[model samples]
Each structure stands twice: as C-alpha cells, then as structure tokens.
Target: MAPVVTGVIDAHVHLWNRATDPQPWIDPTTMAAIDRDFTPGDLERMLDSAGVDAAVVVQASNSAAETRRLLAHPSPRIAGVVGWTDLTADVAAQLDGLDPASRRRLVGIRHLVHIDPDPDWLARPDVGRALDQLGARDLGFDLVVRWWQLPLAATVVAAHPGVRFVVDHLGGIAESDDEAGWEAGWEAGLRELACRPNTFAKISGLAGLVNGGDGARLRRVVDVALDAFGPERLMYGSDWPLAELGAGAVAWRRAVDELVGELSPAERQSIMSGAASVLYGLGG
Candidate 1:
C-alpha cells in the first residue's frame, strides 16, 4: 500500500526540539509549519509507517552541541548523522571534540550554505580546508546550496575529488515556472556536478518545490538528474518536518512513490537504499 519494493534508507531527515534546539530560522511569526518540535519517537512512527528501515538524521541548527545531541539521540532507525559546524573555524577541533563512540554516528557534514551571506563561501580557502578535514575522516560532504550557487558548487566539489560530495535538493532547484530563467542553467550545472565521480545527488526536497505530483516538471528534472548522475549515484531522502512546509509527510511520500515508480526495480532500490548504504556507511 505504501509502495514498498524493499526497505528504504532515508539519507536526509531532521528531528529537532524547538524549545531546546534553538532553531533561529524557524520563527513562529512567519514559518509556522515547522515551528513545532519533532523527536525520535515521531521519527520512528513516521518512518515505520512509510516502510523505511533506516535513516540519517541531519542537523537543522548550526549548533555543535545540537550535533552532539543528535549523535547521542537513541533512535535505532537513525543509521547515520550529518552534523554541523562552523566550517570557517577549526574543523578538526570540532571533529576531535566528539567522543570516539559517538563519532562513529557521523556520516556526513552540512552547512546551511543557502543562507550564507557570502556567495563565495564555498570557494573560500578556509572552507575548502575544512572540507578536506571532513573528507579525511571518511565522512561525506553534503552541499545544500541555492540554485545560483550550483556553478561554484560544481567547482568546489571538483576540487575535492577525494571527498564524497552529495548535492541535496536536486542541486537546489526551486519550484518555478521560470523555464526561461532557471531551466538551462540548472540543467548545465547538474550535468557538470554529476560528471565528478565523487559527487552524488539526492532526489529529495522536490515535495517542497513541485505542485503536488507535478509529473511534467518532476519528470524533466529527475530525468536530467538520472541522466547525469545515474541511479547508483543518486539517493532518496525525505526532508521531513520541513517537508510539512510544502507537502506534508504522507502526501510527499506518495508523491515520491508516484514519480520514482517510473524507474526499474534495481534503480528504485538504489535511490531508496543502495546508495545510502555505501555513501553513508549504513547497514551492510
């Protein structure tokens, strides 16, 4: 009933307690949809209903302490974590600060690069060195940038061939009818980033972009991404809690099922779980 070919391993998910997590971006004055708290209990119930076997809990706030808390969170379904740190600062110190036992929980690192004031933040020498440190520890780097940042993102990811750079949210393509404005550039940038063997893309966040099951637009975008990165390099993710901002949990899951149902069984499994296993070092 939930369109399950096999167990899915969601590669991007967030669980935060707003009262304690200090999510600066979630202002009740405006963004009310995601202003509430969501914890591991909620995560487990949702993932189980969706038939997901495992997941990677990602950071919503830029707090190092929050990352530690996530690493320490006792969710068995959470197979991995993509934490946050001040990339411009001492990256090694941040990684070293983690307890050895908890450190194994880390699967990748992500910064809210979409909100960074400096457009060239990814290209900065300090950030580059920080990414180097991140990759050296065998963790992947999640590139969550805006659409305009894709070109520079490609360049930065290319510069770090050793790092497993994963582009989230279809390389940050926003939902729009501006075919004349963003279509060409997004396609080119996606292809460019896909050319790098070290780079992977997540077929998530589209629920927040498309109008319901926007078959035409979703088809085009996903087709381009699949063509460029292929199924092996792409992974599935449900940007939960935040997905409430666009399509709520149940609806978005159905949307993903409808869209990805186009793929072969093996391809679907790759997006749902296979890539997540290898890239994040999840269950073998």
Candidate 2:
C-alpha cells in the first residue's frame, strides 16, 4: 500500500512581474494562460490548494535585480530562492554583495542556459570558476538545459562534485514529432547524468510535454527518472504558471501523486518533500 504523504515541497516554482523582469520568452498567442505577472499571493493560493507546504521560487529571467526582489519576498511559504547570476562574471563578489538576509534566503543559482546562443556555455572556464565559488559556499546550481545539453550538464556536474546539482524539468523534455527518437536520446543522456552522485532531478515541467498530457508518456519519464536518480535524488515541483499552459496545477499535482503512488512510504516521502528539503537546505 502507498504510504500517506504528510507534506509536499515543490522544488521548482517561478514568480515574475513584467515591470521588473520581462519574460520575453512568453508569447501571448501560445502561452496566453501565463503571460501575465505571477506574484507571491498567486503562488501562495496555488500551494495552499495543492496541499504543498512550501516551494523554492526559481528565477524566471536572467536578472540580478529580479533575484534580489525574489529574495526579499515576505512569503513564509517560499522556502528558498534559486536566483540568477552571470556565469561568466565573479559569482563570489556578486553573492557577497547581497544582504545577509537575502543570502540566507538564497539556496541556489540558475541561468537560462537552454536559450543561450552558445551551446557550450556550461563548459567555459569562467563558468567553471563561478561554479567553484558556489560549491565553496555550499550552494546548489540548478541546470535548466535542453535534452541535447544533458551530456554537457553531466560533464559539468562531474567536474563540480562539491556543488549540489539539480536538473530542472527532467532535462526539459518537450513534445517532439519524432517521439521515439526523442525519448531514446533523452533517456540515454538522463541516465548518464544520473551517474553523477552529486546530481538530482525534478519531476516538474513535464505535464506540458505531450499534446494531451499522455499518462503513459508521463509515467515512462518518471520511471526513467526513478531508475536513474531513485527517490532520494528526485523531487516534485509544480513548475506552476507554466504548468497552467499544460494540465493546470491541480491536474498536474494529481498526476504526480498517482505516478509516485506505488513507491514505499519512505521512498514516496523522499520524492514528495525529503529530497527537496535536503537539496535546498529547507529547515523543518
């Protein structure tokens, strides 16, 4: 029997205000559901309804100002912030510039590497140095990369064993015309990445991958993640407003609940909250 899930911690959620951080990637035509600003209040309501106790608010844009704003948010339900920092810059100084309270709220840093023109950005020497600084401070680095970039991410993860790495959105799997080919490549790359002991993955941002939210496809990806990282290195995330574009938050949450329902109580807890708590340093 599936154990009763006592709590849930969404490891990846994004909040954006267009006035400060313009999400240029969002198109009103296609992503009309989430084109508007998503504030802390909106997030709190969603979490409450989903029964999620807390969430790690991730950066939606590559803006330092946005990061500071997110860190300063007064929402007690926001467990931590995965803010942005320029990978090519002096990451240490940038982090040091933050106030003590903001620094404490920051659990990790991320960059929209998937959209960057340079595919080899993660392999640059300067980026490596910046990642080293994050490791030294005991902070995590969230890798939001395309399926093709998974190997590169794995290489970087292996190099920075000291830094806790969390792969966002199951390596950003999306709907592809060549479904079989896409799954094969994604599975291979994800499995290789899972070999890195310091790496973890989020079962988020996946409900939208398929046209109709195919239950079988979702299960397959989750199972692959389970086989690769296991429950200890896997965490749940609503991916929120973006999820609204797909199955909607409530539906996605229900889907995830059903997907992980077969695991033992301890294993289910790990995926639901334990993994996120440990990875993001969220105190009980």
Candidate 3:
C-alpha cells in the first residue's frame, strides 16, 4: 500500500487569463477543456479537491508581463512562482528590476523551449550567460522540452552545474507514430541527463503522454525515472489544468499514489513534497 503523505506541493501548475496573456498554442477545438481562464479561486478548488497543500505556478507564455501578474496574484496556495524572462537579453537586469516582494516570491524561471523555432535555442551563448545569471541569483531554470530535445537539454544541464534544473514532464515524450523509436531516444536522453547532480525531474504530465491514461505505462515511466533519479531528485507536480486534459488532478494524484506504493514513507514524502520544498526553498 502507498504511504500517506501530507503537505504535498505540486511543482508545476499554470494560471492564465487569456485576455491579458494569450496562449496561442492552445488549439480551441482539441483543447476545449482548458480554453477558458484559470483563476486563483479555481486553482484553490483544484488543490483542495486533490488534497495538494500548495503549488508552484509556472509561466505559460514567454511574456514578462505574465510573470509579473503571476507574482502579484493573491493566491496563498502559490508557494513559488516560476516566471519567464528573455534569455537572449539582460536576464539579470530584467529579474533585478522586479520589486523586492515579487523577487522574494520568485523561485525560478522558464521558457517554452519545446515550441521555440530554433532547435538549438538552449545552446546559444547568450542564453548560457543568462542562465549563469540565474545561478548567481540562486534561482532555478525549468526545462520544458520535447523528446528529441532531451539530449540538447542534457548538454546545457551538464555545462551549468551551478544552475538547478527541473526537467518538466519527464522531459516530455513525443506523440509519434514510431512510439518505440521515440521512447528509446527519450529514455536514453533522460537517463544521461539524470547523471548530473544539479538536475531534477517532475513526475507530472505523464497521463497525457500515454494512450488512455494507462496506469501500467505510467508506472513503468515513473519506475524508470526512479531508477535514474531516485526519490531525492524526483518531485511530484500535478501539471493541473493541463492534467485535466488527461485524467484530471484527483485521478493523477491517485495514480501517483499507486505508482509509488512500494516506496518507503520517507521516499514517498520526498517525491510528494520534500524534494520540491528543497528545490524551491519552500520552508516548513
């Protein structure tokens, strides 16, 4: 049976108001479930239903304005904010420009590298310098990449040992017709990336990756992640509204409980909350 875990902190949740900050990537027809705005109240209800204690809200767009709005959002459940900054520009100046309170709330930064046109965008020298700035400021970088981009991400993670990296969505498996080929590449890249001690992986977004939200397939992926990252470097994230597209937050939480059932109480606690708390500096 799964060990009971309390004070669960979801490391990857997104909140957006489409009118102010648009998510152009969201296809209205296919992604009708999450087409509307997701308010702080909505987030609270979701967390309450899923029994999640708190969450780290992640930026959905590349806009700095969106990040500011998230930082200003009066959500008590938001333990940290992972905002976005222009990696090609003066990252330090832009981040330092934020007011002190906003700065305190900020824990990390991210870019939609998966949708970026440049396949080698993460490897750019300017971006590398910007990442160095984040490290200096004691901030983390969230890597949201596609399956094929895992190796590239691994290269960057290796180069920047100072910058803490949280690999979003198990590095994200591609929905390819050639499932075996893509899975092989993803696993190989993910394992290689895990070799870096500065890196961590989120056990979120897997429900959407598997067909029919198969529990066994999800368990297999989680097991592979455990073997590579162990419970210490692994964290749980609901991926929330996006997860609604898969099995919904409550179901995903239950699935995770089942997946990690064999782990000891302390190990389960690490994945459920401990790892994220340490990574994001969420104090007890």
Top lDDT hit: 3
Alpha-carbon TM-score of each model against the true structure: 0.92, 0.95, 0.95
Those runs of model 2 whose alpha carbons end farther than 4 Å from true positions after fitting are 1-6, 209-211
- Better-scoring candidate (TM-score), 1 or 2: 2
Residue 123 in model 2: shift from native, Å? 0.1
Please estimate how well model 2 matches the true structure, expressed as its whole-model Cα lDDT: 0.87
Tens-place lDDT per residue, model 1, 1-284, is 01122378878889988677877778796669877888899899888777788778889877898899999987778788899988999988878888777788888899888888887889999999988888888888898987778999999988988899999988878667664568888888989999999999998887765546566887889889989999999998888877778776667677777777888999888988988777776654
Model 3 misplaced regions, further than 4 Å: 1-6, 176-180, 209-213
Error of 2 at 79 (Å): 0.2
The digit string of per-residue lDDT tens for model 2 on 1-284 reads 01122368888899999987888889999999998999999999999888888888999888999999999998888888999999798887888898786678898999989988988999999999999898888789999998888989988998988999999999977566565577778899999999998889999997674438577778888999999999999999989889999988878888888889989999999998998877877743
Candidate ranking (lDDT, best to worst): 3, 2, 1
lDDT of 3 by residue, 211-273 (tens): 374556677778889999999999999897998888888888888888888999999999999
lDDT of 1: 0.83
Kindly report which residue stretches of model 1 are placed more than 4 angstroms away from their true locations once superposed.
1-6, 27-30, 178-180, 209-213
Worst 10 residues of 2 by lDDT: 1-10
